[model samples]
Target: MHIRRLAAGLGAAALLLLTAPAAGGAPAVDPVTLDGPGQITDQVGALGSRKPDVEDALRRLDTEHGVQLFVAYVRNFAGRGAQDWADATATKNGLGQNDVLLAVATRDRQYAVSAATDSGFTEDQIREVNATAIEPALRQNDWAGAAIGGADGLGAVLAGDPVPAPAITPGPANPGGDGGAEQFTASDVIIPVVAVGGAGAAALYLFSSRRRKRKDTGGGEPAGWGGDGGAPPVTPLPELDDRAKQLLVETDDAIRTSQEELGFAAAQFGEATAAPFDQAVTSAKEELTRAFRLRQQLDDAYPEDDATRRAMLEEIVHRCTEANKRLDAESASFDQLRQMVTKAPEVLANAEAAAARLPERITAAETALTAMTGEYAESAVTAIAGHPAEARDRLQFATQHLGEARTALDAGDGNTAAVHVRAAEGAVDQAETLAGAVLRREGELREAAAKTAAAIRDTQADLADARGMVTGTRQDESTADLRGRIGRAESVLAEVGREVAAGRYDPLSVLRRVEEADAGLEEALTGAREREDGERRASALLDQALLTARSEVDAARDFITTHRGGIGTRARTRLHEAERHLDQAESLGATDPATALQHAQRADQLGEEARRLAEDDVSGYGGFGGPVPMGGGLNTGMLGGLILGGMLGGGGRRGGGFGGGFGGGFNPGSFGGAGTTGRMGGGGRF
Candidate 1:
């Protein structure tokens, strides 16, 4: 069949050679010379007898489907990629809105296909034809076969037929049997003539000879030949001058608002209220400066070249956006700091009131400890004695920090005051927990034991459910570690149970261990459950994202078709990229749902951007404006100020205002028992 086709076109082949340039020098071919709106230009001459057939097919398709198809055959793409060459040629030739171009670099063995907005074929159809038909034939060194197969496949798809499989045959073997020139029919002579003229044919012969020599030495695919499809249309730059100017104005306003807030905070709260706010103000100032520089650059850049201008404008937008965000955060921080400064004195009074009652509470704890010691032997009630002693020590520490907090507040150091207050509060909480536990053990031993047992059982049930969720799924190290922790907790619970059964158990001790074990088990169970639920949720999200992405791609494609003239090159390119990403998301959905979601989200974003650009709706800086007033709160420093007065005045035994002389290790189970210690008598701030 191949031989017959080659033989029948002998006459056309002769005419092609008759037009060839005389042998001497093969002049360089300009890509523009061979590219036009509705024509197939064969610059490399690889089409041979098949050129007419491919051209006829394209012409017929255009006439019937309102689509234009252009084919280009080049000897080399120079240093340019196949996709780059195709895009440049398409743009330069002023290809029609409904045109498609198939560019093949025969010597380089690379090809790319590009389509205009109204081109009837979708990207998927183009990719399929390239993969199943054109690429296979090209890989086998059958140029005519690729051209014919690609044309047929594209035409069939346009006509609503499934793409046809490539019909390929081996090229003739080299005559010398030493891998010299491949045997060719008389028709082969005309291919080079049509491509580069007669002189070009001489150059072709020499080029073929060199290829054979290279093949003998180190054989590989032709220099540029590969399976890469062409890139999408280049994104044309939007008209960004007005957009940049608007963003600049908005950015300046944000900066001014931020500066005003900073000045107010410094004046009202003394420059040292909160270190974080101060740092944020400084950083925002720096960012504002950078934004100004970027704006200047944007202004200097000309929008004559759409690509360069768009890139410059995008940078400006990014810088301005970040500046605005930083400024807003700084302003909010200032407001919060101002409120805290205003409330400091009231907070101080409240702390003093609370401190006034601490001494009496300490006395009651001491009485309970003394009773526990009298009822049980010191050795038996050893655990209960330690907690109350530690509570006394923590109380002393809390007292000292409170006094320091007062000094800092008096000096207008709210940030320092707040830090001290937090430390004081933590110590107080620990002391209170220890004292309460000791008291509870002394008064309600039996009840505490029962509650501990119930907690253990509940935690066990939760652990079991968590274990069930991850039974067969692949488990990470964290999950495995959680399982081990749960097992340890169960072991601890069993030990507590054994002690209880033996009738020799210290109720306070047993209760403490049980609580610890329950906490650990509950934590482990929660972690495992969250891990399981997170994966399930991620998979579901990915599925929904993929569906949405597909819908977006379809909408973008439809918009391009309906408004071909209205859409710019950049928008059309973005739509193409959206489709590509959607395809990738679908492929990755099963194996990597998280990654799949990322791809789908990107697709959706690009699709929306394309639609926005096409509609010329790209003028605004869409971001946060000047800081709105968030509700205010008191600063931690004010609370610290209150703690200071209480610390200095509330004297207890041990010579510390509250926490002094409370230092001692308490056994976890020894709380709530009677023991004797020196009567609480410390009365000075530590």
Candidate 2:
């Protein structure tokens, strides 16, 4: 298809070339010649030239697009020899491609354009120009256009003298003859052409002029010059120029006002006055108003000079900066005041400390009463230690509860002061339990460290043993014993490392196997080495063991820490219990303000109980009847049930009668009666 279309176009162009007229005859007049820089000379020469190129171009137009065009000039005229002398003149004068053409003849101007017949520059083009430009131009004696316009062949009629009609000499009519040959005069064409052209040009000029005058007189910027489409940047408004400058001055005034207000506020703040903030806020507000006004002025200016605008913008920034500084200072002062209130609890603690340590009346009174419940006992200790000012009375009450419990225990009244003592003990138990967790964590950590040291020793032993085995075994040895042992041990260790990373950290099981492997290798190597090098080899092996042990400890510590924070069953259950019990305790403890000790103790008891229970059960406990044991975080699907003993139990009870592992650690109902040390409500009558 593409080839077919191309061939068709080529054929049409060829047909055009074939149809062009021969250019063998000499021109009727020497073709007007232009040699230099004006297009007029070339234009005239182009029209007047007998050159085959020009004639061929015209013939091509005629054959292709069906247009006959003619050029007109006075006889014996000569000017220049180039193609477009007028265009050459404009080019030499440093004008642009789109600037006015330089062709002139008499008083009127002219233009020239080149066209292909495909462009439809035709005889109709001439008729239209005669109507549009030629007749009018001639009546106005537009000689320049008459000459250049005609030479350019751009649809223009040349001026010609009107000829008077000859007297009619009617010859005797032959059988087939027409009456006569009609003679056309120029007047018949020129009058209507001139009238229509003049009226159209006048109406256009009048309408455009009136609209422009209206826009100017009505105080609008001229639309034609530059509308909102960004023809060029327009000047700023004159009315707002002074307003913009005044805005800067006013902003200075606002700054002064704010400064004055700040000074007043600062003086008040120094005097420990509460009203300073309000005054400072008011001043800041005024400054903000001034800033907004200044911004408005800037906006009204529309566009401004760079220097003045920069100065204005800078002044606005300065005002804002100053206002913010004042606000910051005020905020700092307010924060200091707020800190006094926020630190009340700490201050109260200090006050209680001073009172308790002194041989003061409050401490003496507190000492007079006590309670004997483990809960009360523990609370007594915490109160004694903390000596929180707000809690001093509560502590005194706790001491009383302790005294009561001790009396009941002595008198064999097991229930006496039991609830209070237990409540108090729960508080103490929490601290102790927390301390236990820390200790257990530390012990676990140490045990882990030891395990890691042992593992490292094993790896080093294995590595060393591998070295020894490989050392003794020739590279060509086919024995599977040495490489098989080393490869198996390395694989096991790598598996252990992955388990540790994945939070299935089974230190006991993994370490036991590792220890067995190391022992077997050490024993095997010991006899061989001793036989080979006596004690010297032992010393080197021992040194390597020491380094291996250290590295193992370090690696294990890092492994535990990296995996410790991950979601584990025990940690998740504990965290959930903490959140739940804290929320519950906070809700329940707010009642009975005078019995604040009882309420707060109950709340604390509940929370600590929840936490201890969560850890001790190691089995899942339902939170507000939600699903049991939110499984150990990420790897819960696998090891979660094993660690937390599955979520099958209800009522916070340990699951399934396990003996020593998880559920055996705590029995809350029995715990309440057993006088458990560090437990809430233990050894107390509830």
* Among all candidates shown, the one with the greatest TM-score: 1
Candidate 1 yields a Cα-based lDDT of: 0.51
lDDT of 1 by residue, 36-107 (tens): 444767665566666676677777765665455677766555567666667666655544334566777665
lDDT, candidate 2, 499-537, per-residue tens? 666643534345544544554454445555545442443
- The clash tally of candidate 1 reads 42
User: lDDT of all predictions, in order shown?
Assistant: 0.51, 0.35
